[model samples]
Target: MIHNLFIRTICTALLLASAGCRQLDEEGLQTEVTIRLVMPDSRPVTCLEIRDETSGFYNINTYERTAFPTPDTNTATVRLRRGVYTFTVEAEATYDDGTTCLLRCADYNQITQAITWVREQESIVLLLKSVN
Candidate 1:
């Protein structure tokens, strides 16, 4: 009887210990991005799509436009494949002349931010801007 009771106790202990670990590995392992939108002629724009080159992951947002011609912050959660990434943004904006430049600051600044997600991390914000 004692031997049987000991085996049950050990099994219960193992079960309880397993519960302490995280069940969902992807729970907090999301990449968040924030784009500080700006216009070609210095204006605040909204409704844009952000795409990661290294990873074929993208997110769209309709973040509230900030005060008068300033970059407003937009937040998004992305599932990264675990490594450094170069984020690219495409702002659906048209100038007064009705010309869409796609809104990229510069080729050098193509990689707005680099993130390494070894574990679950909070939302990461990327400032959205365009070439001056």
Candidate 2:
């Protein structure tokens, strides 16, 4: 009877320990994202801006930038929690006449993606042909 009781106690302890370790792993899991911005064929962009679209109690107004030929492909990596997100991007295009114009992603020009963020590296591409 004592041996049976000891075996049961050990199994119970191992079950609880495994559950705790799983919780810790979940807390440490974060989505690793790579965003790529592609410029229009006719309009060559000089700079690009990217930001998360959200306005609430916890405002996500922070943004990042990339310049021409700096990263070449205009790519940036961000870490985010598991959730649905909408990312806004603005491309600054300079014409041969030296006039620079900003093309923003809004309404029909927006890029919305749902990310589970469970994978090690997630890739997203946004083409900047929203403007003619």
Candidate 3:
């Protein structure tokens, strides 16, 4: 009888410990997100702005150069808790003919859209349209 009772007690303790650990993991969960800004032709842009609508946290990055030679120049990776976000990008885009125009983020024919970030890792791509 004592041996059975000891086994039951150990099982119960293990169950409770596991449950507590799961709760802790959920509360501290964070996701690494990669945000990419591109033009309609899949060309990378040099300016980016991201805002977490739920927490009002925002980040902005701007480069002086007009051309982004590499994909890394227009991509940003950040660690964020689960939340909805708004991405805004504005930059000067130079064409092959030496023409320049202002570009801004556009999603589904809209100027800006909310993106939900909930997965362990996410890659978000935003399109930039000519603002002029």
Q: In model 1, how large is the Cα lDDT of residue 101? A: 50
How far residue 99's Cα lies from its native spot in candidate 2, in Å, is 3.1
TM-score of 3: 0.47
The digit string of per-residue lDDT tens for model 2 on 1-132 reads 999999999999999999999988766765567766666556555544432332111112223222222234477676655444544455565655666665554322223332234576687766655454
lDDT (C-alpha, whole model) for all candidates: 0.43, 0.52, 0.57
**Shift of residue 30 alpha carbon in model 2, Å:** 0.9
Better of 1 and 3 by TM-score: 3
Give the TM-scores of the predictions, in the order they appear: 0.38, 0.48, 0.47
**Sort by TM-score, top down from the best:** 2, 3, 1
Cα lDDT, model 3, residue 19? 100
Q: Indicate the worst ten consecutive residues by lDDT in candidate 2.
A: 55-64
Q: lDDT tens string, model 3, 31-59?
A: 67776766666543344333222112232
- For residues 21-44, could you state the per-residue lDDT of candidate 1 as single tens digits? 544444454443333444445654
Q: Which stretches of candidate 2 lie over 4 Å from their true place?
A: 1-27, 42-44, 49-73, 95-97, 106-115, 130-132
Q: Is candidate 2 or candidate 3 better by lDDT?
A: 3
**Per-residue error (Å), model 2, residue 126:** 0.7
